[model samples]
Target chain A: MAGRSVVDAGAPLRDRVAETQPSPASVIATEIKGLVARGDRDQARERFGALVAVLQRRALRVAFQYLRNPDDADEAVQDAFVKVFMHIEQYREDLSFDVWFMRILVNASLDRLKARNRQQRFIAPAPDDDERPVEQVPAAEASSERRLLARERWEQVTRAVANLPDRQRLVFTLSQVDQRTPAEIAAATGMSAATVRVHLFRALRKLRGVLGEQA
Target chain B: MNRREEPDPTLADALDAYRAAAWAEVDAHFDERALESQRQRILQKVAQAGQPARVLAFPGTTTSLRPAAGISRRWISAAAAAGLLVGLVTGQLLHVLPGDAWVHRVAPRAAQPYPSGRLTLIPAVATTDADNALLDAIDVAVTSRGASDLRAFDDLTFAYEPR
Candidate 1:
């Protein structure tokens, strides 16, 4: 069992995935499933609360990266949880619920994206509409030059990620933002492992292209 | 850790570092208060789900309280099926009963001449003038095909008749 350790960026990604410990959300999810089966939905919901607490921050982080809008991310997260609760009975206890839930979250975010797209089609956005930052990180300690450099890099990366096609963006967000393995991403997304790898490769290539151009 | 060869190790490392920094920045952006507020919202939604929701009554209201919107689509389908079955059985029962002479009056059944195994395509219930006109038009169209074809049509119809 891999202990809780910071991922080594220098190492290969698959090894880091292998070293990922079982998530606390998975264990609590199993307990919650049992409670639901026993006809104690109230208790099951209570347990579900704990699972959400464990996963929400990570969930929000992934959602925000994918959506780039805090309101959309917040709404998507809420929708995902409600759907999770409603479908708790269908959950297979043997699998990692965290991955299963991430699948649902990704789907929910996609749904919001489609809806926003539809709305945009019917009504053109105002000229003032901008990709607002979800939250501004205050760089109090960093030098002014360093802070400016970091901001420029952040903008470049964000624009590169946002320019990716929908499927590539989703694959990149899960693999890069959330640090999930290709195999795990395949399971979560109901895609073949090879397909996940191809997507990840294409996504990285695009990002690298963007970075190259910026350079 | 994956066996896939890194196309550009330097680029991979740069991306990884950038991802780590972004994660840290975003994680810090969301404070404890915001998360707790979200938590309370989730718990409140769950609590509301566990209880039976009531419809507010208005003056001179006739609509009854319905099950909460959170009810599954499966349950809604099951209820719809049950209602349909009840309607079908009740309709059959009403037909079986000797009462409801008024129903018979409104929906008078015309004795259909089956044409004795001939392909009789008469409208089952020619209640309207338009229906009768349509049936007449069909009769004219079929009769124009000649007697030999009519006999063949009857034979085809008999082939499809239930045993």
Candidate 2:
């Protein structure tokens, strides 16, 4: 009885529940289960391929954030997807599938990070070839000189954030860039709220000092 | 104790301005559609990969079960046939088979006598009879004394012939 629920591998259950009728994803998942039950490997493999295609982009982004290297990120994402497929019966429909999937991604990222740390391997950031100037606002009161200075200040802040200790850096990125709450960051990082707060405080102080010095 | 609650106007102004700036930056970065797409994709992968199915504690009605709902008569017939087959097979295998077949196939050691002169202490009184009162009393005494599986008196064969 445990680990048997109709879930669409093509889309999330939230979207399916929101639909007026049963979603195609649910139907597909049900069919996949039946195929699996009947020992129809070919059909399961085809469905699995479709599932991977649908999840690749989002998984890539999450992996990219954690691994900071495109190749490593891609590998991690693919591995996580494979793991999810292999252990599909462990999923619970009562919980949001995204949260569950993110849990997998986070765990995979942590494992990779730990392994790399053990090997003393440095993770390099992926190249952002599409980096462009901040879109300009016409009829703004601010002068071009002032805008340039602000942009420079932001750059300094970003650099300061990067230079923070790993814990501080992670807390700052999750809080500011990802807009996750302190509680959420605590949950993801497996740190106490007080610890997260301390990290945030240190990160902010370091950023202010760095940016203020640059100014 | 009621202390004077003096507002630090300078600190308040700085905090307000910082909050506004932070909000503006957050708003600039916000992408609802992107987040939704990510959520959808993650869910899809989870469902497809069967990750969600394993965590579910109970089997529920699926899309396939929905289609099967219309074939009531066929389902009844199939269920009856399956039940009959199982019942017949179980009865034949467990009870109707010959003793020799059971002894050879099921349990070869049924006729062998258990090793004698080793008394196992039963925790509670096993029977309600005046004749078994002695056994019950002995059981209580042995258990209370914490006597382990002690060997019975050697060279003495005691047999109880039931009436």
Clashing pairs in 1: A12-B1, A13-B1, A14-B1, A14-B2, A15-B1
Residue B132 shift from truth in candidate 2, angstroms: 99
TM-score for the B chain of model 2: 0.23
What is the DockQ score, from 0 to 1, of model 2? 0.02
Over A43-155, each residue of candidate 2 has an lDDT whose tens digit, in order, gives 77578555555545555555554565555665566556666656555554433344345546656766677777766656564475333244321123178775554445444
- Best candidate, DockQ-wise? 1
Docking class of 1: incorrect
> TM per model?
0.61, 0.38
Q: Write the per-residue lDDT of candidate 2 for residues B14-34, one digit (tens) a residue.
A: 223332333334333324554
Candidate 2: stretches off by over 4 Å: A1-62, A114-151, B1-163
lDDT winner: 1
Among these predicted structures, which one has the highest TM-score? 1
Give the worst 10-residue stretch by lDDT in candidate 2 chain A.
Answer: A1-10
DockQ of each: 0.15, 0.02
